[model samples]
Target: MVYPKTGSLIVRDGREMTYTHIQANQTPSRSVCFFFPGASYSFDRPYLYYSTMLFLSKQIDLVHVNAAYGKDIPDFETSSFAKRSAWISEDVKTVVFQVLDQQEYEHVFFLGKSLGTVPIACSLLKEPRFSRSSAILLTPLLREELVVADLLALEQNVFLVSGTADPHYHQPTLERIITSKPNIHRYLPQNAKHSLDIGLQVDLSLQVLQSIMDELGCFLDKSLDI
Candidate 1:
């Protein structure tokens, strides 16, 4: 009985932000996962798409933030990194608060990839209301000092994934977080890029994807005590 409902809201100077809410229509939703895609990645991309399915399978509802910033908002392309991050945070918060106001969810999970992780690290994860929420940061901008600092400050459980080949992957930074923050679990895939795909190795890339999903499932099970 799981189904999806799509809706849109105006945010950040009249820009449109569309989001899809998915859950079992007949079942009461106690948990929800908010998906924040990368600048060039959409919800239909392999990682986000499969993750959406995985959450639904576990009976955790989902909200896909279809914020097409680079394309829909011309200002996004010209804005500085700080400005862009703030814009993203505003858009995400607007959609998330609206959804939460409509219904109460006991558990809140934020999953972000690359550019999307900025808001998760800079805003959502820092907010008092979400201090108890968990986070899944896929290929986060490890090179960014601010993002890494925020991530290190987290107290709730977090699942972090990165690839050795990804330009954003910083060894020293990751080591620091891992050593200091025992609550954050990490997965490092060798020779994988930002997309978590092995360059031109289709089969191996698929296997990597499978492994990530498996680890994510285990994380959810353990975190939820299910």
Candidate 2:
């Protein structure tokens, strides 16, 4: 498959955000997936690449939101947590609105990893359009009340893939939350870390990622009923 095209746009707040657009080349499913990376990660990472390929293989277009910390925006590291979180949420909402306004997508899906899940969760409360959409949350920081509340509020299907050893959430708490929501499909891979890397061996990490991709493929097929 061809690589995605890079594009940049200025949001309403005058903060510039970069995104990658990948058009569907085969089946033209008319579905789109908006990807949000972790705090320090970008769309070029291996995980994002794997996800983009998965969606493309299904003929789903991709819109990957690059991290806003490195450009003209204020450094997230130095800013207060509340301020940074708000900014991230606003940025994501703006991008989503822009994309939807410009395209004619029949189905919208949000794929978020780690800190990225915060904005996806927040958008569900702030934007009514997202309430009807699906979500794939990788290593979601469920410790936040907003995340938990949004997850509870979502009536659509949600696929949550996390590690058994993720530090951001307690296993028992995660289990309880999953048990409370029948719409959520949970996957907990053993000995995996927050990034879903099994260990220091690169080969083993890639193998684990393949397993994740297989799981994600099944979830996508079920969620989209394809």
Candidate 3:
């Protein structure tokens, strides 16, 4: 089947998939995003990924990628969370290449949440194409290798953001370690957390996200018209 030049679609198992694509007027803007969903959920889920749409739509055209859990969903019931993220990264890498081809995006940007950060980071390290664009990491899970890989990134513009009172992790402390090591712009929201919405209140998270998106939009190619 021929792909349309406008909206984005995913053909998984030959099924024409309707993705959560938000396309503004087709201007010369960077129209692609690598939305790496957290391990606990997929792209279509509201709480994890969808919750950030309000802030994202204003910045650029979007495509929310579902997490690939290999042959089955990752569970504490079997493998560790870290392991699942690794497996999903391979699948997500495949998806990214497919989308980049189908979407015909000029400028590429990355958006990864929680566990999604690691594998995507690794993929960028291995392949050179993804490194051409900026990376906006949301509440990432970092390891020694990820830190090492980050410094090796070909893409200079990196945005690292998280909350002060993150409910599930202590990544905020690690921010300082990586923040100055590279060309990273850091934002630890006044009181944000793992999810964009922390403390069960999304208002603060949403505000911070909007602020970040505004900055990103400013840098987007002016050709993608307002």
Sorted by TM-score, highest first, which candidate order results? 1, 2, 3
Off by over 4 Å in 3: 1-22, 26-30, 41-59, 68-77, 80-83, 143-155, 167-180, 198-226
Predicted candidate 3 versus true structure: per-residue lDDT over 1-226, tens digit per residue: 1121433334333333334544544453355566667766576555334434533554556656655444443352376654554555555666667666656777666677776666656565457665456666677664445444453453446666666666534554455556645566666676676665556566765677677565555544332342
Writing each residue's lDDT as its tens digit, candidate 2 over 47-134 gives 7778988998888888888855644554666776566778788777777777778777888889988888887766643476655678
Return the TM-score for each candidate structure.
0.96, 0.87, 0.66
lDDT at 141, model 1: 95
C-alpha lDDT values of all predictions: 0.89, 0.77, 0.56
Full candidate order by lDDT, most accurate first: 1, 2, 3
Encode model 1's per-residue lDDT on 1-226: one tens digit a residue.
6888898999978778899889855665799999999989888899998998889889999998887766656778888777888888998999999999987899999999899888998899888999789889999999887787788888888999999999999999988987899999999999999999999999999999999999999999887783
Per-candidate clash tally: 0, 0, 3
Who is ahead in TM-score, 1 or 3?
Answer: 1
Candidate 1, residue 194: how far the Cα is off, in Å: 0.9
What pairs collide in candidate 3?
28-223, 28-224, 29-224
